[model samples]
Target: MTEKTAETKVTEAQRAALGLAQLSEDERRRGLLSIADAIDEHHEEILEANERDVTAGEELLAAGEYSQALVDRLKLSASKLDSISEMVRSVAHQDDPLEKTLAARRLDEGLDLYKVAVPIGVVGTVFESRPDALVQIAALCLKSGNAVILKGGSEASHSNRVLYELIREATAELPDGWAQLVEAREDVDALLEMDDSIDLLMPRGSSEFVRYIQNNTSIPVLGHTEGICHVYVDEAADLEMASDVAYDAKVQYPAVCNAVETLLVHEDVAEEFLPEIAARYEQAGVELRGDDATREIVEEAEAATEDDWSTEYGDLVLSIKVVDSLEAALDHITTYGSKHTESIVTDDDERASRFMRSLDSASVFHNASTRFSDGYRFGLGAEVGISTGKIHARGPVGLEGLTTYKYHLEGDGHVVASYAGDDVKPYLHEELEAEWTPGDRSDE
Candidate 1:
């Protein structure tokens, strides 16, 4: 098909999504709850379709065409489906992000100004093998009153197709094409070019893939290209607690982006903490590559090079470094970190405060595991994706991130001449406690 043909589909979808944008908050909330219930009721169908995708993924794994991580993400169990349902329900119950008055000011008597949140029109999301992302993105879009066009990896095609169908059916009573699925790879290329209809593009995958989307598309992109996350153990950290937190951060879910890939330890604590953590990592089958000082403390660790510092292993392999001071650790992270998530384990409150304030990552933590950097964990129901970019949205993008605001001015036949002429009515720009309620029109 021609480019115009593809743009027409997106245009239709955007039109449908705009209809949803005009809906009352209660109407949208009930519609999302209904979609969540429908998903739960159709869990078996989703699981059956997921099994087909898993089988295909296994074949690809055996042929060396797919990584173990992709296969794991492609497979879906009953519990995962239930969790997806729960997240959908949670999003449905979240405060509607649309039409809430952010600020109000009285321009003059019988004239008022208000800023209200609204949807970002149509969002085009291209994600990799986690089929559950299809449901998560659709639910968040519906709750935020944005239309979305989803393109999931071919690895989970069967699962994504089933999930998309279920979501479309569940929200059928609303707009006709609020949630559209584009399965073909060529369609993604077409989508990247449709900047007019698609307001935002969120691509979730490798750094290269995200960069490719950002470079190829004129549509504003909102997502992290990589997640070279790190965890630092300060000199004042309790060695036992440091080891526990570090172990959990790497092993809780190594396949995810938030999993810590680099571990930095203060030189004062390195000798004692290194061996303890190394032994624990051994038990978890984690491979360690470290700097000269770290290797001196832990003989089992392999020699780490400059490249190791910036690598996102996304596996059990971890790179460890020994920093002489907190300043050195911060400098190391600033040079190599992906600005996704970083954490410092320390008992020194002042040192922790400095570390937290100085770092520029999306999420900074003190005395916590980096694994805690998640949307569900942050009580955002679930995320469309994590963004390391500093504009529009940052960190876990949930309902609030999916929306933008519009300024609404109400006036009684007010004209600029009244405020500008010699017979000028002195203008009042007073802040008002009054907000924009539904059906409050100045014309009435």
Candidate 2:
């Protein structure tokens, strides 16, 4: 693949998106299959490039410039590559997202209006650490009929280049510039300037980074910032189930954004639950910090500061707090939570319902781990990223998230002047169970 400037890429992507949007769903599915097939055929090449990236990442990690979590996300093995391929295939199999009528209504005697789904044109995504995100984002955009401009972390440069090139080559039969990979750090600045060309910007990073993007860009921003998630153990909870859920939330995979960062325990259960869960955390090499009430129960825990409540460790480190009631837990989470994901462990259905309904986070769970707040796990095929914001898409963003709707109005010899005249014909505005199709007439 030849390198292109950000301006050129964005312009090409705009044109390509128009062409891609006109293709049949089957044609788009075929393009996704090509990408999956390419991954299967060139798995070794992708891994070799990933190995080089991992080596460089290791050197940076040893120098203390990179976190272990960052390096872990940088490396990819044979199984990871297989998963990537399967992800693309799964995207292909998703029910078609475009051109489906969302709502239809009769406007007049021979006129009807329909709300139909359409692509968001060009999406520019800036993510860190995970090169696999490049594939997931690209496959989702292709399947949803949008052109994607992917800018992954500098740490995964080599791996991203190989994967982007493979995808671009694989989908050669489709529009040429459907997927554009921008490798330079400065390219992000260029991307921000082209709000007219790029319909949306999804940036996955720190709050500061996402804020910078939002502050600088006029384009609609879908920000995926820190995941300071919480797991609250209510007084009515089962100790065993609480232990299992909290353990998996924090220990199952602590490197991702959805992993639990803070643990809230009811004062009623503090004495009994603190020692039990702390032992499991300690055995897993997790560093635990707790409030006074918790430290009184678990002697091994370090003192947790106010800052610890809002931190996203993204590691095997957890901050614990003891709350007097479910309401206290809700107040603490509201003040410190990132609005990403939170779970409440309680056997009482009323308490669980209250917890699930009251929190403003993107995902809420009852007696389940925060780790399950994922797109693929939520049956979204795959996710571009999880949006904490309330606009457009929230939680795990899949093909549906990538789409926005258009109003398709079908009228036969109809004009607004007719409705303005003194002998105006009144519109019989009514909802209809109809799909939008060309040359289809309404029941006259």
Candidate 3:
């Protein structure tokens, strides 16, 4: 048997992704819709595969090899599969993200320039547990006219493989191997080294795992390392509303990345709000760790350590703190936050505005739970991931984030020499309204 090298597999996948990129926007959209339909039609098959993975995961959990949170993330219910299908349909309904003219300028007579959106070529994503992510990534990549290589965690290997097979079959007519799946753990190292072939890398997992991927890969990564999200209850906040928001942020879905792991209460409200929220947390079986001031109010709260402020405890655990003022809260967030999500509960508009503006996280909120910082809830149809990085995309990365732009210059025998020397033609740098029409090539 010929030994297949990692480089060989990546090269093959990249070639397929590039081929998919050549598809027209309309074709890409159709392909996405087709995949969605296929998912709906084959839901049972996917569920069957998911059950196998879940059963295996339960055994691992019983053996103490996996956390309950990992088991929760790995399980795929029928509703989740349905939601995944709907998300694919939503991506198809969105406006085509390719070839949109972002800017147009008339350089000179018969010479025009255009900045247009285009696909980012090949995208490589390594995600954990959630097999549904495989569908989301493939749909978003197809809609944006990019090829994708997905590597999901081994725990969900069966489910991921089934979903990948469905997506590949649906997209088979468009471009050969438009979606590729790599399941081997060793392939991750190989994929990271293929920077020349992969344009972007998105790793979704633990902080340490994301860091490991970033350290090993030369490919540009677009993901947050951790989500140490927080919700601050301002002194002027309505105590009832603040308590409700804080509770929802932590208790609604404690295992996800967007869940709030820290709660900051103002000194004025700490005496009243801490005990109330603590009672609520206790009802939900959430363990509360607090600072000195917070511990004084909630006697049951264990004393929080410095490390508690920075940890992303993706479980039913929360760290609480009491600050003298909003500024103190902001300082604490600045020092310990992962720049993922932060929320403030305040009735005062000025203070709310200030908090929203001053916080430097990717998604900042006022009078809302940190849980609202989601791609689907934000209405990007679906998100590839939440990006904390500042360069390409900042918040929920949808189809727009999956794309880059190209400069398209059009001219009829126009030369730069005409505008260079003395007595040269005057260059006209006038803005013009332009749209990309089919068959409009730069060479034209």
The candidate maximizing TM-score is 2
Candidate 3, backbone clash total: 0
Q: Which ten residues in a row have the lowest lDDT in candidate 3?
A: 435-444
Residue 358 in model 3: lDDT = 92
Q: Which one is best on lDDT?
A: 2
Give the clashing residue pairs of candidate 1, or none: none
- Candidate 1 structure lDDT: 0.89
Of 2 and 3, the candidate ahead on TM-score is 2
For each candidate, what TM-score against the reference? 0.96, 0.98, 0.95
RMSD, each candidate, Å?
Answer: 2.3, 1.2, 2.2
In order, what lDDT does every prediction score? 0.89, 0.94, 0.87
Over 95-122, each residue of candidate 2 has an lDDT whose tens digit, in order, gives 9999998999998877999999999999
Candidate 2, superposed: residue stretches over 4 Å from native: none
> 197-251 in candidate 1: lDDT tens per residue?
8999999998889989988988899975678999999999988899989999999
Cα displacement (angstroms), candidate 2, residue 253, comes to: 0.9
Can you write out model 3's per-residue Cα lDDT over 1-444, one digit (the tens) per residue?
A: 965566665677678777776777778888888888888898789889989999999999999999888888888887887898889988888888888999988787678888999899888999998887888888888888887888899999999988888887887788776677887889999898888898999999877888998888889999756789999999999999999999999999888888999999999988888888899999999999999998888999999999999998889999999999989999999999989999999999999998889988999998899888887888888888888889899888998999999988877787778888887888788888767554343423
